[model samples]
Target: MFRVLALALVLSVSFAGVVPNPATDGDRGEYVTLSVPENTSLGAYTLADGETTVRLPDRTVSGLVALAADPALARNLTDARVVRVPGFPRLANGGETLVLRRNGTVVDRLTYENAPESEVFADGGWRPLGATDFQTATASDVAVSAFALPDAPQRVLAALRGAEERVLLAGYTFSSPRVARVLAAAADRGVRVRVLVEGGPVGGVAVNSARVLGDLAAAGVEVRVFDGPRSRYAYHHAKYAVVDDRALVTSENWKPGGVGGHATRGWGVVLRNPAVADHLAAVHAADSTWRDGVAWSTYRANATFQDGAPATAAYRSDFAAWNGTADASVFVTPEDGHQTTLGVLRNASERLLVQQVHIDDARFLNATLDAARRGVRTRVLLGGAWYVREENRALVERLRTTARDEGLPLRARVVDPRSRFDHLHVKGVVTENAALVGSLNWNHESVVENREVMVQLRGGAVADYYARVFRADWRGGVWRLPLCVLAVTVGIVLGAAGVMWRRVSFSGSGRSGVPRRVPRPPSSR
Candidate 1:
């Protein structure tokens, strides 16, 4: 029975209007019909069975299906005693009829046979926008905390605070009590706060992840949990903030434990570009269109929210200059594929420095080894927790032997994540001097499942800074340093054999292409 309830809860919360079906008009006449006004009550409704259900609230005298992008309408919706239908892409011919009734009485039967779009009820549906087309809207910002972001957050917060407008932030998780406090403070100052957490139980429903929910609530924040379906293990992990007119986007989730979670480091960017933020906010608006999913009386946010400094304190991005012109040092990783990065390093005339957490794909290993053989010096900084990701252990061991045989200078040292289990979530690729940063993970899963973004930074202080960090890790005697030094020396000597330093350079595209020949005097970028 418990299993069935849990299963039912998980499924119902997966979509919008997720309340269980009412007892039917025959059983309860205290309800109103949607279109026909025959019988409609929050007590019961028909469920699509394993798909979605529209549970009405006892307080709901009627229901409203609004799809326009209106914050006022969206925020005031929860108090309307109405069921917010989850908006989805419908397959039916441009027609969707939304009928509403109060106390078994007909109220409104709005129909749009030619809806611009309709949401096909799925386990998960996006937030609904108003019916009126939402092309453009003015923006106002609010300052939540003492810290500042690059531009978007700053401007958005400014507007919010000045205007005392409502703010809705969407991200994968929200466990930062400090952030929560800031939000709470904002609420205390009379600003409305709402967060659409990916891991919430359902639309404004809470089953688990209560700490996350509670902190925000204590701050006078209004949170709508998006339980739109998909997977119990799945979540809406996108990060963006929708202020009055702008939004913020980046690769960061708002969780305290996540920083050191399982050895994976993360990244985020405060997208100040209005157009970009607007588009992202639009997406957020679309997701919250309906009060969908099964109603969980309560939820517990698995993670905790502790006070802490911003994420940038750990992984920072500083602007650099090239050729006397200051350039923003932005390297984004769009999930997984590294063709662009590989091309840059493939053209390397001198060296390649890599620091990654895991690599289930052997091709990437071969590529690195191949670069060494072509005369370009290749160095690798591996995570100590690679064992946790054993799928690539054999490949790594094989690469070790090949490095010994060809003397192609390939060394690896795992970063001892003693303080954190396996949180080394960074992907850095360098060539002689150029560096790659952003958010791409070097794994088959990253390539296939996750969306990543990255940037190519060439010839500048950032590149040099990356090199310096590499050097410190490579030569520093932390557990993996000695092994790295030996590997570097061996790959260089074996590959180079007797080639003089002055005569050396990458064999192909400035980077040593294969494991066939040894080059000399790698050009120092």
Candidate 2:
């Protein structure tokens, strides 16, 4: 009698939501759902049951189906689709693996366990059966922090202030008075400070780089303009800094909007890794010493302005002390093949989450499409700025067709133009266990013909943090919430739910491709 009651209780609660055994699934076997709204039908979709497979009508079907042990439990899905497969293997109460495929192409592979209590997980956040540990990040020897616009200036300043030794900075443009003042202050303190900015106006647009370069040069900061015409690359568009063995990589220019005053939405990463710092510093050295680069004093003869003011410091930090360990490395283009970023996308077995400013390179787009073809779920959040180039807007249509006609598991969305942030200028990629963050974009010019930099981080607290940030950004933001809010929210949810956690598992092999390599450009501007 007791056994009967217990079985009844389990059955009663099973249909409430997730499968009962949530803990048994292995790391790569993380479960997910392709939510089917009411009355919607997945045309030509099929569900498999052991050696047998059943095909649902090309038309719509209404019902809930579990890839688990009990098919009856599906009746509870008032809003989910029911793919009826007679003789479908019952989902094990302990745990079961379910793979969904279409036309022999894998769609999703989910491993689920029965839950001890009733609850739901949505939008990457969890809610309890009735239930939350919120805490702050403690300082560590090797730490990483992410900063976005309207607040990047504060963090950028903090990074600058924390520098105790030499500072090397390379940017496409340098017009931010706030950042200029900070650089001047660093120089004044007897710290070796050197800067490199673009030498000439790009695409007929007059740049204030010459004036900013002159001011920094006058302030005793070693400043030079990159001689792009003599170099193999078309431009020195990479924006990054190396200070005292710490690396600051960003996808923003050094203007009031880009880094200082936070007038634009951008992404920045601070990595306390000696190897990464050394590599970036080397890149800066190479560009600074380019054969054709003219000293700021010499370039000032063609300046657009006679002078500029010392930049004021407004950068701050809401992040905890730097003390997170990461397996981080620097990847520079026109030197290295920019393989690190491509490798992350090619190796994604389960998912690829990216926020890119533009996508025009065929090879880059092909790699992403190939991953989706192999059953890797892909989501690309694109910037909505009107200036994002017409070619990219067309690429979006191509990607959409690739997903629809080829039945690939891919989705792309343009950010709402009305968001608080001006432009989504972030170039970031998050895989199951790694992340790529930096100034490299997915375009022919960026990957093949221009200088770029990025930090490739694999498995660690830092990678996890990046993945969380990507997920949140994928969901449009309210803008004012600082990074701490995400950390606290997760803590509260976990603390509230007495639920046992399971590890996520992923699987996939890596592929390699050669990007168009350009020799070092000529040495004159």
Candidate that scores best on lDDT: 2
Q: Mind giving the per-residue lDDT tens digits that candidate 2 earns over 401-426?
A: 87999998998877652334556777
Task: Give the lDDT of residue 262 in candidate 1.
Answer: 18
Error of 1 at 367 (Å): 4.7
Quantify how close model 1 is to the true structure by its C-alpha RMSD in Å: 18.3
Q: Point out where model 1 deviates above 4 Å.
A: 1-171, 187-197, 200-209, 217-253, 259-349, 362-374, 386-395, 417-423, 431-439, 451-459, 475-525
TM-score winner: 2
Off by over 4 Å in 2: 1-142, 201-209, 303-323, 478-525
TM-score of 2: 0.59
lDDT of candidate 1 over 1-525, digit per residue (tens): 999966643332111221111112221111111321223244433322223324344332434322212224334333223334332112223334444333333333334333222122212332222211223222223211111112122322343343255566765556555456666767787776677665442243222345656767665677755553332223454555655543444334454433212113432223233443455455455445444322223334333333333243232212121122112232222222556666766777678888676665555766777788888877776655535446335546766778888887776655554322224545667776466654455766454333333435445444565575556545532222345688998787756644554244433343464544554334432
lDDT of 2: 0.62
